[model samples]
Target: MRRYLPSLSALHAFEAAARYMNFTRAADDLGLTQSGISRQIRNLEEFLGATLFHRSGPRLVLTETGANYYRNLALTLDRLEEISIDAVRGRSVDSSLMIGTHPTLASRWLPERLGAFIGSYPDIPLEVMPAMPSTDFETTQLDVAILRGVGTWLHARSIELFPEVLAVVASPALIPPGSKLDPLQFAEFPLLQNAGRPSLWLNWLRLAKLSYSGRIQGTRFAHHEMIINAAIHGLGLAVVPTFYIRQEVANGQLHMPFGEPVQSDDSYYLVYPERKFHNPNVIVFRDWLLRSLRKA
Candidate 1:
């Protein structure tokens, strides 16, 4: 006969206690009394024939074996929870897709082009979440994400959505009339910078073969919108993504003085976990996104 494993409830109690090193907190997390949680851990340890915790006064510490076991168990449990949640959510929604992306991209780029996607997949409901720096896709209920990076996704499989072409853009108001100065003359104005891409201005200048005294001097902002707004107001020239400022340029709010565009290694990518590739919702969303990019 094969041996039976302990119940999930007992294993969960043990994991919580091992993590917090406090029965009271574990009880709170599990919604059980401190004594009840203790009982569960004791039962689990007894069933396993090993001591999982060392009780020292009010504090609890994991033994060497307990530490090793907890490390492996926690990882397994986390993955299990992820899979369980995915399965449950997948069954609940047959035509809904959840996507996550940076706020700037969602605001400036996706809004204009998403109508095409909606037109093709009229039956599918697309849910977009503005993912912040701290958002983790594995823990969250996200089906896909559009991320900005140097084509590297640590855990997720990534596909290049678009290459970022950066250029020095300014309002027509800033340039003097009948003044056709060389590229180095750009150093005269206050430089607007993007905090996420500090080296953008320098890279663009280098690509234009322009030399300036204050190559690295500039005022930096966190979002691309702020940089564009500053440039539109004629505060200074900004190195911004061409796709982001397409509407502004068309409206004459911003002007790219340089005839050439500079391409950056960093670009937008569509990413999702390898396991989710076969999911119907994920597949539909990925295909729609790729098609939209192609049209753009």
Candidate 2:
């Protein structure tokens, strides 16, 4: 028998106790008495020759070693539960693929293209979640994420899908017939802004080799989709990603006042945990995504 291998009951007790940081709550969760929970944890600690918790009155706090152990153990327990559930259901261990991405990509880019991936792999259950705040494999169950960034995420593998190419666009009504406006002239109009990228207008002006001292004032929106929609309604000139407004531009809903799209330093990337490099679902989705984008 392995000396380091603690009993399942002790492990469960420690996990529950650490999570709640209250032995009574842990006992209630596991249908055990408070003392029973305490005894299990104590025995486990003695077995490991390490104090896992610091008891101060009624409150319990995890020690440094305990915190590290809990993080890894929690993940292991979650994976074990998933595998057990799959086994009971008579399916593969990893039966689902959860993808996290921004709303812009989810609504505009993915909705039209998801069907192809679904058609190719019917067995893998798919769930698309909004990558709110930030996506972290350690903290989230997401198998993969499509994020807009410079292609660098800690403890994760990232592959750039495409560089962010921006273009100055406005409603056709905003731009008169056969009229070309220079950078300074275009700045005179109401310039819509993306709240996330507040420096976009200033950067574009500097990139265009012009310095405007006026404060950039407009209705700022959180997402590019909102900016595009606002631009279509003739609110103001919106600088948006060129690829995002392709259909809008082609269908005469929005018009580009600029000659060519400006490439940004950031790019959209397919990011995933380094551990999931060999995941079949991720691989299939990655390949399909690249092929689809190339065709588009």
State which candidate has the highest lDDT: 2
TM-score of every candidate relative to the true structure = 0.66, 0.70
Per-residue alpha-carbon lDDT of model 2 for 63-131, expressed as tens digits?
A: 999998888888888788878878798875576888999888888988888998889888888889888
Quantify all predictions' global Cα lDDT against the true fold.
0.78, 0.84
| TM match of model 1 to true structure | 0.66
User: Which whole-number lDDT from 0 to 100 does residue 68 have in model 2?
Assistant: 89
Clashes of each: 0, 0
Name the weakest run of 10 consecutive residues (lDDT summed) in model 2.
132-141
**Location of the lowest summed lDDT over 10 successive residues in candidate 1:** 132-141
